[model samples]
Each structure stands twice: as C-alpha cells, then as structure tokens.
Target: MSRALLARNGRRALPLIYGGRRGTDTLSGVHLAARRFIVDMSYSAHFMDFKGSSIASSMKKLVVTKLSPNFREAVSTQTVAVPTPGDADLLVRNRFVGINASDINYSAGRYDPSVKPPFDAGFEGIGEVVGLGLSASSRYTVGDTVAYFGSGAFAEYTVVPAKEAVPVPAVKPEFLTLLVSGATAYIALKRLGDLAKGETVLVTAAAGGTGQFAVQFAKQAGCHVIGTCSTNEKAGFLKSIGCDRPINYTAEDLAKTLKKEYPQGIDVVYESVGGSVLELAVNSLANKGRLIVIGFISGYQSASGIPPFKGGTLPVKLLQKSASIRGFFLPHFLGDYREAMSSMIQMFAKGQLVCEVDFGDLAEEGKFVGLDAVFRAVDYMYAGRNLGKVVVEVAPPSVSNSKL
Candidate 1:
C-alpha cells in the first residue's frame, strides 16, 4: 500500500519519495493531512466528536539551562510551539533521538556561548514527516520512515531540510539507532578515512557511539578492524559489533598491542576519543595512514582547562611517518549531501552496517525519567560505561511502539 493510504489510517509515518528537483504536489500535501489525522487520532474520543480543527500544538524539548563547566546545571527542558517547516524543510514527528558527547559539550559551553542558551540540543535522530511547506519536494510522503539532521530532535518535533533527511529501508526501529550512529561512521570511514578493502582500521573509543559504527563499517569495507575500549566487557561488545581485535585500553598498552597485532601498523584510525588514546593511535599509524579526528570526548569535561592535544605531538608524529590527520564534521559535508546520504542508505539496505544502542535500563518500561536522565547518560558515556550509542528516549509513549 502507498504511504498516503497508510497515512490516512493515522499510522506514524516517514518520507516516501527520493531525489528530484524540489517542488510541491498533491503527494506532498499528504503530509499536512497525515498530521491532522494523527492529531485527531491522539485526542480523546469525546474531542473526536467535535468537528473543529482545535489541535493541541505544543512540544517539549531538552534545553540547555546554563553554560557550566560541570555536567550538572548544563541541561534542562522547556515546552515550546512546534515549528513549521520552511519551503525546503519537513516537520518531523521525532521518535528516537541519539545522544552524543558533543551534545553534552555544547550544553557545557565548550563551543561559542554567543549562540545563547536555553536553546534545544540534539544532533540527529529518526522521525516521520508529518508536514511540509508548499514548495517542498515529492521525495517523501507523510508516512515514510526517515533519518534526519537537526538541532531539535531533543524535542517531540524537529524541522530538517528535505534534502537532509534520508528515506530509511524497511528495517526495525532499533536499527534507526544504527542510522544515527552508523551513518556517521560510514561517512567518516568512506569520506575522511578513505577506507580501502582489506586495509587495517583502528578505532579509539571503539565501544562508544561512533566507534561501534566505525568498527562495523570498516569490517564491511573488508578491513581488518581493531577497537580500543576501556574494559574487557566493552572489548567483548566491540567484538560482537565486528571488531576483529578489541584492545582493552585499561589492561594493555595500545601501541604495544597494535604493534603486536599488526606490525605493519594501521591504514586508518578513527579518532573519536582524544587524550592518551589519541597519542597512542598516532604512533601506531602506518606510512600514508589517515587519522580522522571525529571527536574529542575524552577532554569534554576536563576541569583543568587543557587543550585537547599538546600541539607538538601531532605534528611530530605527522612529520616522522609522513602521515596525515583530517578533521570531519558531518554538517560541512552538506555540499555533497545527496551522494553521502545515498551511500549510507544503500549500505543500510544491504545489511552491511550494524548499530548498537544503550537504551538505558529505565527505558525497559514505557516510563522515562527526565532530562536529568539525559545528563546521567552523557556522564555514563564519558565515564566509558555505555556499550554503544547512548540514546535518551524523549516522550517515551511516542516511541514505545517503535521497532528495533
């Protein structure tokens, strides 16, 4: 059945169409209709008897309360009106929102504080397009599942550029977590790392959000994958996610372990965790190896006000081996947005990617704690307690029915 038909039944939905010039049509109009249907369906049956268009239209969002040096006082929540989509945007009914260390960094004022505070915080998530603007394209219908990029996924609804949302294959909702973390890993591996088949790839913080995806992506690219985690438990988890060798950073020396495992050194290193691990990773690089600096989660909460890396070491390593280090932020790749998104979607469709998530023990029931829980999750992430992508379920009832 077409998404439009399914949408008529008031089922949650995502985008249905794909690439083309941007414009609107009857199909695009279905988004508004579907949203109306959902709003109508959600009301009490008594309100259903009323024939007026009085839809309750507020959304709850995780907001930054104050820019603090510590994790506490960094995050909070507020209710706001759901935003309308722009001509090139889609208003998504967010389901599962992925939490990353960067979100915490922004909350703690690591970035420019001039951006202001009490704003929504989130990087990426999966959702259904409930509405679009008049000039919106037909690349998606109201009910198709999609992965999107936007700042407000920490809320019940978010607006993403239509071009920035990717139509997901018919996979379980849990896999959307993979789409969130896995796609980032895939883009970093393919675009930044320039991963080649049979090459050896190493990922620091390999058991964390982006690292888990890096391990699986590198393995799918036919690379011998090695991962660094803080504990044996996490190391085992990394192996389950396709890392051929898992180095327990707490138990072993990374440089010695890498030298013992691959004496020739690694072709690419996905450096998401900086600090000593990053230092060890650079030393383990092979001739012409690429080190992709994706994040510096290790230094996220440093109270000493230290720089992420002592400047001399990176340059010294680069000069010694003639290796290169490249930094990547997914948003900057928006120029080739279509191609990057297509590559991820195809890999997902082919089952070449695996996504792991730490759904919080509290998530077992439909009940969720609060934004405080989000802070705890982020803390656990920095403390190296989470096994995979740590996602805080916003509006649990909305996502309770989501598939894995």
Candidate 2:
C-alpha cells in the first residue's frame, strides 16, 4: 500500500517509502528495501489504471529522448521516474492527451526560445488528480477530472499548479468539442473575427481539428461558411456540418472558384494553412473584411519556420479593401474563456455540438492507443485523413468498488 513520489520541476527523486515500511534514509538501503518488499506483491495493484494507480517513483511518458533536433523527428517514448509535486503542484494521472501542431513544432526546437533538448513533450490533456503537495489548493480532490493546457502533457503523469486545471463537464472531455479545438474555434471567430450574421466566411484546411469547429460555429452564427479541403470525402464531411459550400481543392482551382463563384469576396477569412493558401485568402477578402491568423501550419515543418506568401502588393490589396488581418494565439485568450467554455460544454452535453471520434487505423492496425500511436496520429492529421479532433488515449480512469 506504500507509494513513492518525489519531484522537482518534473524530475523524479527518491521515494519516501521503499519496502513496505519507512525508507532506511540511504541510497543502498532504498534499493534493498524495494527488492525485499516487491517479492510477493506485484506492482500491478498500483498502475492498472490512471485513477486507480497509486503514486509510484517512476513512470512512462513521451520525451524528447533524441531529436533530429526538429519536429519531423520530434519525440520518442521513454520510461522515467515520476517526480514529486512541488508544494503548490497537483499530480495528475493522464487519461486523454491532445496533439497540436505546436507539439510538432516544439519537437523541432521551436516554441519557447529557452527550452533545451531532452525536455518533456505535450501541451494539453485531461486526467484525474491523484496526488497533491501540502501547499496545493484544496479546491480539487484526488480523482476529480481536470483538463489543462500546459507542459508535460504527453506523460502518464503530470504536475500542474491548481489554478491551471479546468474542471470538465461531468461528460467525457473530448478535446475536439472542448478546450483545444472547440474553444479555439469559438474564441477565434467570436472574439477576433467579430463575425456578423449572413457574412461570407471562408475557412482554409476546413476539415481539420480546429477548422471543423470554425466552420460549424460560423454557420451557427448565420454566416455563409465556405470550407476548403483536399478531398471529395472531406468536402462531403464539411457539407454535413452545415458549410454552405465545400470546395474540394484537389478537384477545383481555389482561386478560379473564388473569382467565378463569389465575386463579392469573403467577409471573414479564417486562415491556418499559410504560404500559398494565405496569399489566396488575402486576395479574396471583401471590403472591411477581417482575416484571423491562427497558425501557419503550412510552414510548421519547414526549416525556415516561416510560411512563404505571395511577394507583391500583399499590403496594398488589404489597404484597398479596407481589410485587416489579426493573429490569434489561444494561450493569450485562455484566462477569459471560462464562460465561453462552459457554454460550449453545455452545447456538447445537450447534443448541440457534434461529438465524433476517429476509429480509422492508418499506421496502426485498427485504432490508435497509448503514446506510441501519437506519432501516427500526427502523421494522419498532416495527411488530412482525420475528420475531427485527434485525441490520444493515454490511460483510462479506474473505478473502484469501495463505497463512499
């Protein structure tokens, strides 16, 4: 029944318990104690499930073990001891973790300028609190389901400050319908775009994790939503979600279609795929239109770390139309989103927001499972195979029979 967990800045330390009794308080004695106690009781009782697992000294989580030094060769699975929570930290046992384009970019040494190699990977995930530091806030209990957007998310366990954790609705927290994708979609459109009813909105890479939400929200706002995807199947999915027009870029010339079909120009352009797509989207803006730049996914894999745009008059065209482009980064807007996220959770819980999970197997055989499949999940997303949010199942919650 003894569990050992000691950590500092996400690094593991010696356990307070070694054998079934108080630790001997020495390095050699600690190892000797574990061997003495673990002979009969299998470690199985501790780690079978995230919610049920007792705190342990070591754990398994994804890390930047070796890098091609970039996202293309981003991360690898490694087994490392779990760390003790700081006085103000809560140790969370992860259930489902999210994969964003930034995760890949970070693998390539992109995100923060000061982070070094062999660092922990992941930014967003959901799980239950299992352990807490003495000074940690009492607002949450051990086993309370929580969602967060911060570091060390790709692991089986993560330590976060109490204030950072967001309580999920009693329903399962789908990354697609909540924090990362759904919230980003809701915030970008409502706060940044200030979308007007019946306005023409164009969404690029429209079938993606965030774009799908953008499309639905824009439609719900009474805007004419036009989505761009690479395939007929994706286009069809877009249509099913209320997109007014689905342009299959694989079969249609985007520029020509925009010119011939909507000469009035697009009112709000949600541009994520930059480079050529951004250039085209910029040229397609209506008077007083607003283009919200979420991410330049097109340049994520590039060494230059910048998505290239058409060379000339990019500024002049925007000026001529009284149009403007503003960048939207979700992290900056997270603090103000509690009310909006609560509303979004209500929408999903009541069956208003679509809840779809991808079961198709690409690199794996049938379905994605555990941390190994995250790389494949990212590849599938890059290949445009996923129709909704790409969520990685880390560990399922444990249900105990003990009556409260």
Candidate 3:
C-alpha cells in the first residue's frame, strides 16, 4: 500500500480497494509492487449476503431509489454502485433500523428532501461497524454495535462520521428505541424546558415517541408528570410508564381536566402534538411555566388552515406570569449531543428508562416487501395503526432461518 493510502491512524484507506475497476487519483500518483494504484472517493455502501450476492437484487428485496410526495406511487428501487468511505467515515453493516414519524413525513414529502432522488430514507438506527476509513479508530471498531442519528439509515449499510456513532451498551435491541427517542426528549427537556426537580409537567401526545420519553424523563427529574393521550388504553399505558395522571383527551376537556387535576397549574408543558392540544396546553400553564414545543404531529397533514385559538390569546400572560414557550429540534443541539447521550445511556443502563416498539414482524410473517412497501407503512403510521415506535425489519444476510 502506498503511504498516501495510509491515514493518520495507520489503517490503509479501503476506498482505493472498494472503488470500481477504473479508479482516478489525480491527487497523487503512488507506485506499489510495480503497479499504479488509484484512489476513488465515494460515500455510500450496500448490504450483501455473506456469500457476496446483493440482498436487494431480487424484486422482493429491491432497494429504494427515489421518493416523491405520494407514498402510493412516488418510491422506486434500482441497483446502484456502493460508495467508498471518506477518511473520517466508518462503513456500518446495519442490523435493525428504528422508524420515527419524521421518516414517514419525509417519505410523504412533508419536508424538503435534502438529497435528490435515488437516495435512501431513515434517520436513526443501530448497526455494527464492519469497515473503517484510514482515520477511523478506537472510537468505533469492527464488530462493535452502535447507534446513530442521520440519513441513509433505511438501507442495509450506511457511512457516518466517527463522532456520530455511539457504542451500544450491553442491552437488548429493544433498548435502542429508547436511546434514539429518549435522547431527543432528554435534551429538549433539560435545555429548552429548564425542567427542575419536583416541578410539575404536562406532556401532550404523551403516548407517542417523544412523548413517552418526556413522561419518563420528567418523572426521573423528580417532577409530577401528567400525560395526555387519545384513548383510555393509551392513558393506561402512560400511567404504567410513571405518569402521575393520564388525561384522555377524547373523552374530557383537556383544560378542565388539567384544572381539576393540578389545580395549581403545571410547571412545564412538553408539547409534541400541536393544534387543539397546543392551545389547551397554553391555557393550562402555571405561573412562570415554560412550554417546550418539540413537534407538531397534529399538523403533519393539515389541508385546512390551523385552527384559531379559542377566544383571544395574548402574550400578556407571559408578562403577567413570567412564562415562556420554546421550540426545539434535536439536530440543532449537536454541540450538546454527547452530554445528552451519556445521560440517556446511564438511564438505560440502570433500567430507569424503557422503550416500546410496535414490531411489524415482517420478516417472521413473510409480510416483508421491497422498498415500495414503505408507503403502506407510512399510511399505517399516519392512521394511528401502530401503537408505538413502528419498525420494518430488514433481514441480515447471515441469518437464514427465514424468520427475521
């Protein structure tokens, strides 16, 4: 191997070996073993069986190639060359990918598709580090399980920055659902909500992904947690997760129930479901209360205008009560990701936080389909068909039991 192919960590660059037969290295010309080696720099990879056949080559396992607004007709699959790793990137062999409402939104074209067509979908997942770039090191090693927050998580393989990958503790795969969702909730509550010990918190959509984490996080923070859910069963689930009181919004007036339950008002509002729920939450704020707006799932598909707040709401309440409302996005807080992740990992290690998964059982039941089936899954999520974090399992190449 040429000296140029060896990075600072002393590992030879795998990019040169993985690149196609015709490689270009205008950067430098290095001779080794009486032959010229060219380096190719690409940033993507594919999942193949241990036998070296692409897992997505068949129609049933076709890889996703494009996305559009309509889930029913916008997605397609195609065969593309696997990309090479960058100097600071690690190639991960994905085991299980966690699905979130954000994935559904992007698939349905609810947000701008940052990457053009022919790109994979998904934002969070757990994988094993299979290959590393020249500069990759002790932070991640091959065979170590890890979790990350970034795109391309839907596919069989993905490349991410060394810093974004965190080693998975000795926990079951189910625990990852909490780490991915809980980390975001923990950061939002700690940083934006300024949650304090013994405070009271009201969490909207308290049965969903972030809401579930918010409820547990608030309880762990020594706060009295009140969770609002759409159904009595969900209310029971919330209470089982440490909620002090579960409000069934479908049957009772939220503001009236809050007034009856808290009486003195709540200290913080973890608002994930906006629209009517948001307005009700604002009306139930306590003196000096802070409202943390994490997501607007209620408005994900609103064709009509946002509903007007009942009567005239005023910022005067903020001035009179010293209250405030804030919004948070996890990606924007990358600077504090390490602290947030560390806290969550400790919580998981101690069983202080729990995760719920609505496993599709696609692989076991033989219901698994190609990339095109993603749209149907999104529809199921939007229709509230899934009870918890919804996931579609992609069978790994090494597993041959037919049931994933």
Ranked by TM-score from best down, the candidates are 2, 1, 3
Which candidate achieves the best TM-score against the true structure? 2
Could you list the CA RMSD of all candidates, in the order they appear? 7.5, 10.0, 9.2
TM-score of 1: 0.76
Per-residue lDDT of 1-404 in model 3, one digit per residue for the tens?
33222332333435544322232211111111222223334332321122222223222222334454344444555445444456667766666666666664565544554655554677776766555554554333344456777877766667778766766643144655754577778888888888789899988878876788899889988899998887888888998899998888789887887888788788899987777777777777889989888776766554321333453554776677788888887778877777776666666666777777665543333333333445555666666655556655554444432112
**Candidate 2 lDDT, tens digit per residue, 1-404?**
33232232333332332234433322111111212222212212121122345556678877875444354466878888886566567778777877777677778776675777788888887877676654453344445566777888889889888777776633254633367777788898989898889899999988887888899899989999999998888888998899899999989999999999999999999988999999888889999999999998888777766787875897899889999999998878976577666677667757777755553354455566777777777777776677777777776555542111
lDDT of each: 0.65, 0.72, 0.63
State the displacement of the C-alpha of residue 272, model 1, in Å, after optimal TM-score superposition.
1.3
TM-scores of the candidates in the order shown:
0.76, 0.82, 0.76
CA error at residue 64 for candidate 3, angstroms? 8.6
Which regions of candidate 2 fall more than 4 Å away from where they truly are? 1-51, 54-56, 65-72, 135-137, 170-177, 359-364, 399-404
